[model samples]
Structures are given as structure tokens and as C-alpha cells.
Target: MKKMKWALLMVVVLVLAACSTEQPGSKSSSDNEDAGKDGDKEFKIGLSVSTLNNPFFVTLSEGAKEQAKESGAKIIVVDAQDDASKQASDVEDLIQQGVDLLIINPTDSEAVVSAVESANNSNIPVITVDRSAEGGEVVSHIASDNKAGGVLAGEYLLELLGENAKVAELEGIAGSSAARDRGEGFNEAVDGKVDIVAKQTANFNRAEGLTVMENILQANPEITGVFAHNDEMALGALEAIQSAGKDIVVIGFDATDDAVKSVKDGKLAATIAQKPEEIGKKAMEAAVAVLNGEDVDADIPVDLELIKE
Candidate 1:
């Protein structure tokens, strides 16, 4: 009887040890499976924008957020309100958060380079949307072809003005990729063809556009047409033209709802329509691909449309 009891105790100890080791391994495998299915284990992205004040950027944000939700990834969105330093700080904060990917529409391309470098050092992939940083190897860049859109605007303006009219150009924020590229294309289209009497920068603001248009009008009273880099500035220029009692044809970009209505109402002539929602969707999709270790192109160009009424 003593031998039987000792044998039974030994059997029980062996059984318990076997159960303990098997249970932990099973649990670990189950946890790994759950992480894979839900993508909750190690996927996060960050999006930083110059400002949320513009409806265009707001739409972009909404699309990105929706896509991130569907992909089971966390996205941190930061708005810089057009402040370059704030944008840099926001990127730094996202980097510290250990994000797996970064998407940025920089306030100032040059100023955001260092912040992008910080993320690159951490092995995080960076994607630029709508705007680009000056010096960086971003995994992907998604935006409308601003230069092509500008050429379209110029050609449309020339057609509306009967091919020989004096025009004024209202530029966006200085030193921006959009501003430089769009101006280049516009000048190319209008070179030796039309009279660009005055050119000025409006910083892509409505009030500044109004003030700058007022100055241009003082210098060249016969300005028959106006070309603003964006619709907000175009609207401002329209207001200034109306206030000055001058009948001028105007063209703009980024056909916002207000700009579209203005075109319908005959207040503005035409605009180049860029699909902001599509831009947002593409950015998020590229981000997910990068997270999954898929290869993507460095530049993704969204097509632009010309809107006329």
C-alpha cells in the first residue's frame, strides 16, 4: 500500500507539469492569432497638416480617418494652423509616440525636413500628401498635378478672354511646391501670349488676396482677368474687383463649394477642380500598404478637372 500511494503521487505531479506547459503555449498562439486578425499588435500612423481651417484639408482628414478605422490602425492627426514650428513639433510628438508610419502636408516644406528625418531614423515610413518636404526620401507622395492644373487654368483664361487680354496673377504662399510649380506652368502657358500686367503673393488667404488685388488694381487699372492660385484667394479678388467697380474675369484652383457656386452665379469664370477626398483616400491606402511591407511609388498623381460655367 505504501508503494502504490507513492506511485499515485508521482503520476499526479507529472500530469500537472504537462498541463502547465501546454496551456501557456496554447494561450500565446491564440494571442498571436488575435493580433494578426485585428491588426492591433503593432500598426499606428500619424498625419500632420498645415491647417484644418480650410475645407479642403478637413475633407482630407475625414477620408484618412475613415480609412484608418477600416484598416484597424490608430491614426494621430495634428493641425498646425499654418505655423511651421508647430508643424515640426507635431511631427516630433508623433515620432515619440512610436508610430509605424507618418503622413504630412507640411506648413513649410523646408522646415519639416528635420522632423521627417527623425521619423526616418526610427525606421518609420513617411508619406507626403498634397505638399512635399524639400529634402527627404518619403516612401510615397500623393497630390494633384499642380503644374498641369495651372496650365489648364491659364488656357481657360485665355479662351475666355479671347486670347489677348491683360491679366493679374495672385500667388499662394511663397516657396511652396504648389506655388512654384503652378506658377511655372501658368507662365509657360501664357508666355508671349497674354499680358500679365501684375503678379503678387496672397499667402493663400482671403484678406491678403483682397489687399493684394487692391494694390494690383492701383498699378494696372486695365487688368481684364485675374488668376488666383486657390479659390479662396480668387473669391477675395472677386470681392475687390466688385468693390472697385471693375468688370474683370477671374480663374482659380481647388474648386471648393463656394467657388463652384461663384462660377454658377457668374461671379467667377472658371476653376480647376482637384478631388481632395480622393487625395485623402489614396494617402491612407498607401500608408496601409507601407505598414504591410508593400512597395509603392514615390509620387502618386491624382488627375485634375477643369470646371467652367
Candidate 2:
């Protein structure tokens, strides 16, 4: 009887040991912990773009979307339609959706401050892309050096036109940091070297640029060069100049697809390449880093290049 009882006890001990041992294709407690550390949970990111009408912003959004997919995150994109109030509303809606983070390309720099602050109030980090907010806490600002790009445009225009060059400026939307910085740099580079016949705002609209360029041409018939804040305006101005039978060295920013083709076709004089897609990729990476509690630079700059025919 003692032997039988001892054998039963040994059998019970062996059963318990087998039960505790991990089997093939079975997950142990440590395996589950490791899976958790790998971040099975998907993070949602909100992207508020100023406008998608421009091909540049469209490419930028596409880049961010691709990065989000690769990083196992979701991104929601909203278009402001170049309306500051609408952009603010879109941001409020995004905040209500409990987005983990926000990437904003503001229609207007000053108008976006309130939206940025709202994201800040909710403890959600904000990343600015291509444009910046005048105020509010931003985890990162990703863009090219607009002022430097402008200087490059100016210097190249000077090279093409030389001294005594009479140029007109086609400015972008009012209250935009891009317009302000680019204009400042361009003016600084060409100050006292060229005759700035006319400078006006085209609101960065191609049609408006056409109209504005037409008016500028009428007012300054001797205009020999043009510097538009963006490619849309530059292309518009090009159309106007071509129609008027005038030969003007038109320099544009944001070497968009159309602008690049124009340069290759010898229609556009030159353009500053901002690599909008890269800017978008960097912004998404920064968003992921911020969510992972990793430190990112306050300002992230993409490379810029001068594209000439």
C-alpha cells in the first residue's frame, strides 16, 4: 500500500511539471510581455493640411500616409481649403476625436496659433509641416529653409538678368511665414541691385497670379524678371508673360512636378526644390518618435536645391 501511494504521488508531480512546461506553438507569459513591448496597439495621427489643391501638398500627404502604414499607425488628413477659420474648426474636430498627435500645415501662420494651443491644452503634441504657427507649443517643425531658398532664387535670377534687371514680385497669402521669410530673403539679396518695379500678392492662386501678373505687366512694361513665392504663382506669371509676348526670367519656389517639367521644357527659368515628400516623411517619423516618448528636435529642416533648366 505504501508503494502504490508513493507511485501515485510521483505521477501527480509529473503531471503538474508537464502542465507548467511550455509546449510548441504555445505562448508563454514572457512571450506575451514581449509582444506588448512590440506595440501591438496602433497609434492614430491627425494631419491638418492647408489645402490639397496644390500638387505639392498632395505629395506631402501621400508621403506621410506611406510612413504611417509602414510604422503601423493611422493618419487622418483634413484640408482647410485655404480657409483659416475652417482649419481651426478641423483642428477642434480632430482634438475631439482623441488623436494621439497633430501635424498641421497652416493656411495662415498667425491664425493657426489658436489651433495649436488647443492641441496643447489636450496634452497632445503638435508638429508643424511646411508652415508654422506664430504661437503655441510645438513638438517639432519640419520644413525647408524658406529664406535660404529665396536667397538662392534671388541670386540665380540676378545671375540670369545681371544688373539693371527690372523684376516684379508675386507674393503669397498674407500672414504666411513662407511669404514673409521668402520675401525678406529675396529683397535682401536683390536690394539696390535690381529695380523692383512692382510687388503684389497673388494669394498663391494660379488664377490670381495670372491676373496679378497681367496687371503688373501693364503697370511695369519694362519688367525683365519675376520672383513668385510659389510655383503656382510662377507658372501663372509665366502664362501671362508668354501671352503678352514678353521674355521675363521667372523664378519660383517649391519645385513641384509641374514646375520641374516647366524647367525642363525651358518654360520656367528656375525653381527652388523643397522636397515636400521628404518633409512629410520626416514629420511622420517625428510624430512616431514623440508618441514613443523619444526626444525630437524642435526644428527639423529638409534639404533644398535649386532646379534650373
Candidate 3:
């Protein structure tokens, strides 16, 4: 009888252990691991935008947010306001929120490395959109070919201006990959063919673009063409040129709404369309793939096109 009682107690203990392992709130190591799989728990994604002040970044954010809703995923977007330190702080806040994945559009490539490394330390996958981070592990990068877009702008400008055409370049923010790569490709295409009269950094702001272009115009009065790293600067430069009563062929990058309207109105010459919305959608898709533990391309390239009226 004693032996029977001992066996019954052991069985009861084993049953209780089994039940405890699968309690109402307990999750197994493999349970709800793949967010893309059916009936799994929803995944949370964090997006760090450089700045939403620009229409380009605003459209990009809209695309990502829309796709997140469609995919039944939660997304948190933080704007850096073009401040690198603010971006870093935003990323730390995202990390504290326990987001499953991170997508960053860096204000500066080098400044974003520490933020990326922080996500890496927490074992969270990262994807960079529009601009790149200079260091750390990233699951994927989604952007248009900035260098190729620059080359397109250069080639088109040369076609319009012909030989010996003097041009001024309005550069984007310093230490940004988009600025560097675009400048490289533009220089490669126009070197020895055209004279770049004045090149200045406008920090990708319209006000600064106008001020810098005003300065360049004052210094180099004979320039006939201009190539701005982005449309904001291009539009600003156009304003300065119009005010100075100069007829310069201004080519810009990123066909933002204002730039497109300017082109249509014959106020701006041309622009390279980076398709910021597509880039955002692609970044969101990559985030989902990373959360699903699926393999994704290291570099995802969106198509680019030149827009002119």
C-alpha cells in the first residue's frame, strides 16, 4: 500500500510540472517566433527618420506606416529633426520599447554607427533606409542608387549645357553617404568636360541653400548651370538665380512634390526621382523578413529615373 501511494504522488508531481510549463501566459522558445507565420503574435518595428520636415521623408514615413497597418504589424516612427544626437536618443528610446526590429534613415552616416551598434548589442536586426550607417550589422539596406542618379543628372546637364559650361553645385549635408556618392558620380561624369565654378554645402536646408547659392552667385557671376544634391537645395538655388535675373539650368535630385511642380511650371529644369515611397515599403518588407528569420538581400536597390518638363 505504501509503494502504491509513493507512485501516485510522483505521477501527480509530474502532471503539475507539465501543466506549469504551458500556463496561460507562458511562451515556449519557439512559440510566436516567426511574425510572418499565421496566428503568431504581432511584431513591433521601429523607424528612425532623419527628418520629417522634408516632403521626401514625410512621404517615405507614410508609405512605411501604411504598409505596417496592412501587414498587421505595429510601427513606431521617430523623427530626428536633422540632428544626429537627437537620432541617437530616438534609437535608444526605441530599444527601450522592446521593438523586434529597427529601421533607420540616418542624419549622418558616421554618427549613426553607435546607434546601430546599440541595436546589435541587443540582438535586434536593423535595416537602413534612404541613407546608410557607416558601421554595425545591418540585415539589409533599401535605397535608390544615389551615385547612378548623380551620373544621370550630370549626363543630362552636360547634354543641355554642352561644352565649356560652367556650373555651381549645391551639396547636401556633410559626411552623408548620399552627398559623397552623388558628388563622386557627378564629378566623374563632368570632370574635364565642364567647369564646376562653385561648390558649397547647404546642409540640405532650403534657407541655407538660398544663402549659399546667393554667395556662390556673388562670387561666380558667369555660371550657366547648377546641380543640387536634392530638390530642396535646387529650388532654393533657382529662387536665388531668378532674383539675380540669371538664366541657369538647375538640375536637382529627389523629385519631391515641390520640385515636380517647379519643373512643370518651367521654374526648375530637371530632377532625379529616388521614389522615396518605394524605398520605405521595401524597408518595411525587409524588417518583416528579418523578424521571420528569412534571408534578405544585403543591399536592396530601388529604381531611379530622371524627371524633366
What local lDDT score does residue 9 receive in model 1, on the 0 to 100 scale? 100
lDDT of 1: 0.87
Q: Kindly give the number of clashing pairs for every candidate.
A: 0, 0, 0
CA error at residue 108 for candidate 1, angstroms:
1.8
Q: Write the per-residue lDDT of candidate 3 for residues 117-147, one digit (tens) a residue.
A: 9999999999999899999998899999999
| lDDT values for all models | 0.87, 0.93, 0.92
Better of 1 and 3 by lDDT: 3
- Measured by lDDT, the strongest candidate is 2
- Per-residue lDDT of model 1, residues 52-150, tens digit only: 977778888888988877777778999989888898899889988888899999877788898888888888899999888898669999999999999
Local accuracy of candidate 2 as per-residue lDDT tens digits, 1-309: 999999999999999988887777887676555232255556789999999998889999999998988888889999999999999999999999999999999999999999999999999999999988999999899999999998999999999999778999999999999999899999989999999989999988888999999999998999999999999999999999999998889999999999999999999999999999999999999999999899999999999999998
Ranking by TM-score: 1, 2, 3
lDDT of 2: 0.93
RMSD per model, one decimal: 3.0, 4.4, 4.8
For candidate 2, which ten residues in a row score worst on lDDT?
31-40
How much is 30 displaced in model 2, in angstroms? 20
The TM-scores of all predictions, comma-separated, are 0.89, 0.89, 0.89
As a TM-score, model 3 comes out at 0.89
